[model samples]
Target: MVFFNKVGKVALGSRLRLMTAIITDDAAKVYELYEADFMPKWFPVFYTLTEEREITITEIANEIGHSQPSVSKIVQEMITAGLVNDNLKTTDKRRNIVALTEKGLILSKKIKLQCIDVEAAVESLISESNHNLWAALEEWEFLLEQKSLFKRVNEQKKMRESQDVQIIEYTPEYQEAFKALNEEWISTYFEMEEADYKALDNPKEYILDKGGKILVALYKNEPVGVCALIKMNDENYDFEMAKMAVSPKAQGKSIGWLLGEAIVKNAKELGASKLYLESNTILKPAINLYHKLGFEKVSGLATPYKRCNIQMELIIK
Candidate 1:
C-alpha cells in the first residue's frame, strides 16, 4: 500500500489510530440505529456500570484501565445525558459512588442486543481475514508489557551508534584518555581512594605488568571508554573486572557495554573461569548493565574502596 510504502513501520501508531476511529465511528452508528443514545467512548465506562451497580470514580478507572480524571469526565457526560447518577457517597464518605439511572437501564437492554450482533459480526470479520488480529493484539500487548517500545528502540539506536566504535588494546599514547575517563566518573560519584589512584596512575605496573589487561573504546579515533581486567589469584574467581568508565559525551552510544564485553572476551581467551566486579548501589545504571552482562550478586568478599557496597560475579566457564 502507498501508506506503508511511504511512511514504513514508524507509521504504526497513526495506522492503528485511523483504524480505531473507523471502528468507533461504526459503533456510534450502530448505537444510533438501536435508538440508544450513547457515545462510543462511553462504552467501557457504561459496561462497567452495568456489571457493578455502584462504584466510585477511582474504582471505575481501575476496572476500565483508564485514568481517574478520564473516568470522572465520562461520568459527568453520562450524568448530563441523564443516563447515570453519582450523587451517593461511599461508606467512608470520601468518594462519590456512581450508578446507572432508570433511563440508562432501559438503554442497557438495547445495547445488550446490539453487542450480540457486534460480537458475531466481529468474529465473522476475523475468520474471513488472513490474520487473527484479536490474538495478535493480545500478544502485542503482552510483549510491550515485558519490554516497552521505548527501550527496544533505544537499544536499536545504541547498537547502531556503537557500530562506529572500535575496541582496541592498551597503548602508551592513550594512557591519559584512560585515566581522565575513570577519574571523571569516580570523582562525580565518590572521592577516589588510594587503590583507584594506584591502578589508574600506574596501569602499566599495577595492572598490565601484573598479568592484567586493559581495553579502550575509540570513536572517530578518540578514546571514549575504558575497562580493565585485573588478574586475581583466587580459587573461585580468576579476574576482577574494574575501572570501567565512559566519556559523558559518549554516554548513550553503548561504549560502556562494548568495553565491558571486550573485557569479558579477553578474559575468556586468557583461560579465566569467572569475573568478579564491585560496585555501589547508587550507580543504578552501571549495576543494571552488569546484570545485563550476566553478573549475579554475591557476598563474603573484602574490598578496599568504601564505595564498593555491592559485589557481583559472572561465571564464564
Candidate 2:
C-alpha cells in the first residue's frame, strides 16, 4: 500500500479520481447478510437441504461458495447457539454430519419471513416517495462531509488496507523471507527464542502440520504480518490459534486486525468450531482488537504456553 508521488507540471488545476472507495462492513453485518440472504430459504431449494436431513460442512461450504474451513467455523457458531448439531455421522463416527437444531430452523424461517416483509415495506416507500428518499440521503452525505481531515484519515488507513498480502505455501526461497520475519521477532515477541540457518525452523511448518494454515501479509518485497493455526484441543471443536505476529514497522496499520480476520475466515474454511488466543496483558491494544473482533475472556487457564498471560477464545461458527 505504498503511496507514490508523481512528477507533474500542471497549470494549478488537477483532479485525481480514486480507484475504489473502501467498503467498511463489519463481521456482524456480514454474518447477518449471510444468514438472511441464504440459509433455510435458499438452501432448502438450492441444494434440497433441510433441518431434518443430515448435512456436512463441505456441502454447506460448496453451497455458500466459501472456503470449507470458513463454513465450518460458521457451522460451529450455529452449533453453539443450538442452531446446528452433531446429529449424525458415518458408522466410524469420525465422519461427522452437521444438522440444524430446532432453534436454527425456526430462526431462519422467522428471519426469512420478516426480511420479506421489510423489503416489501421499503419498496412501498420507494413507490410512494422516490425523490425524497434519494434526496434525503444525498443531503445527508453532503451535510456529513468534512474536508481534508476525512480524506487524510482514510488515506492513512489505506496505507495498510489495500496491501497485497496473500497466502503462500512455505518454500526454501520463501524460507529466508520467513526466517526474516522470525528473526525480526527472535526473542521478545516471537516465541521467546531465535536462531538462523540449521536451527531456524519456520513456524508455518509447525502450523501446517496441525491441519491448519499459514497466511503471510506482504508489502511488495517485505513481509509485514504472519498468522498460523495450530491444533490445540479436541473439546468444543478443537484447535487453537498460535504464532500470530505482525511486524513492528506495521503497527497501528490494521495489520493485526487483518491477520485476525484472516484467521477467523481461515478457521471457518477449515471447519473449526471455536478459536482461542493467548496473549500477555502488556498487549492491551491486541486484547482490545481481539474483543473488537469478537473474542471473549474465560475464568480458568486455557492455554499451554505459560508466556500467554491472557487467553481469549472465539466460537467461530
The top-ranked prediction according to lDDT is 1
TM-score of each: 0.93, 0.46
- Candidate 1 error regions (>4 Å): 233-237
lDDT of 1 by residue, 1-317 (tens): 58877999999988899899999899889999998889999999999999889989899899889999999999999999999998686667777889999999999989999999999999999999999999999999999999999999999999899999999999888889889999999999999899999998999999999899999999988899999999887889999999999999999999988888899999999999899999999999999999999999999988999999999999996
Runs of candidate 2 exceeding 4 Å displacement? 1-156, 159-161, 167-169, 179-183, 189-205, 299-302
lDDT of 1: 0.93
User: Which candidate comes out best when scored by TM-score?
Assistant: 1
Give the least accurate 10-residue stretch of model 1, judged by summed lDDT: 87-96
What TM-score does prediction 1 earn?
0.93
Q: Give the Å shift of residue 105 in candidate 1.
A: 0.8
In angstroms, the error of model 2 at 227 is 0.7
